[model samples]
Target chain A: SQTIHQWPATLVQPVGSPLSLECTVEGTSNPNLYWYRQAAGRGLQLLFYSVGIGQISSEVPQNLSASRPQDRQFILSSKKLLLSDSGFYLCAWSDYQETQYFGPGTRLLVL
Target chain B: QQQVKQSPQSLIVQKGGISIINCAYENTAFDYFPWYQQFPGKGPALLIAIRPDVSEKKEGRFTISFNKSAKQFSLHIMDSQPGDSATYFCAASTGSGGSNYKLTFGKGTLLTVNP
Candidate 1:
């Protein structure tokens, strides 16, 4: 069985502060990883996705960036956070473009 | 034409009643349709999915009905329970070998099953 883990389940940060959210999947290798943000009452918007290490694709232009430092590790980062950046961030993994499995998620609030 | 339109932004149903959510897409290239269920403050979970080749697919109490001609699909929950109260999102994807492996999702429907 594969499990996805995300940390700082909840985060509160002031404006212009740096942001870093981590996601990792255990029991799977070379899986497709994705970063999504869900605003209140809105559908998820894909921010970034990676097919392999050091390969990241941005779905939409924004302040956030993603990196696949390791095969199973993905990180979402921002040099400076904006008030609009506050939302529930989700990390998902899929095997061969199949069904996606999401993590618990990280609730980020930029005040 | 990548939008997936969903209807009934919110729904309220009583226990044991049936819950239905509809979604329509404009992209004919989309071959995979999936429905996801999300609890408050949580990531959406894959509930049921259907392929364009199938008219309907049922899993336990959940079912996905796909209309290839209309470019529409829907999810039906039979004998809905209080636990079924959550946000439901309908999504479509082109699957592998096209554009990118990203899903285009609906705005989501909030389902409340009153006990």
Candidate 2:
């Protein structure tokens, strides 16, 4: 069975700080990876998606960026975080069927 | 622009009652439709899905009804339970395989099944 992992499960940071969130999938190779953010009581917003290593597509212009350093490893980063950047970050993986499976997610709080 | 639109921003239903959520799409190229259920602070999970070729598909207590002519689809939960209380999302996408497909999701509906 395939599983996805993300960390830290919860994060708290001051404004203007750097941000880094990691996502890794096991039991699958060359899977499509995606980054999404959900604000409080809001819908999911696609931030970035990658087809392969070093290939990333930005769905919307925002303060965050994504990188696929490895086949199953994806990272979401920001040089400086804004108050609006705080939200629940989700990592998802999918195969050719277009059915996406999600990770536990990371909750970031900016003060 | 929002390609998929879902109705009922919030719903409250008593236990054992039926729960229904509706979604409509404008894009005719979309061949895949899926519904996701999300608990508080958790990632959304795929609950059920239906292809355009099928008018209705049922699995266990969940069912997906697709109306190709109206460009609409809906999810029905029979005998709704408190455990079914969660946020539901509807998504549609074009293409079938590979990394070429991207899903356009609805704003989401919060469903609360009172016990």
Q: For candidate 2, what is the lDDT?
A: 0.93
Q: What is the lDDT, from 0 to 100, of the residue B113 in candidate 1? A: 98
Residue A107 in model 1: lDDT: 96
For model 1, the DockQ equals 0.66
Which tens-of-lDDT digit does each residue in B1-109 have in candidate 1? Answer: 9999998899999999999999999999888888999999888999998889889999999999989998989999999999999999999888757434688899999
What is candidate 2's lDDT per residue for B21-95, written digit by digit as tens? Answer: 999999898999999999998999999999999999999989999999999999999999999999999999885
Q: How well is each residue in A1-111 modelled by candidate 2, as lDDT tens digits? A: 999999999999999999999999999989989999999999999999998999999999988899999999999999999999989999999888888899999999999
Q: Weakest 10 consecutive residues, lDDT, candidate 1 chain A? A: A93-102
Q: Give lDDT: candidate 1, residue A27.
A: 96
Query: Per-prediction TM-score, chain A only?
Result: 0.98, 0.98
Alpha-carbon runs more than 4 Å astray in model 2: none
> TM-score, each model?
0.97, 0.98
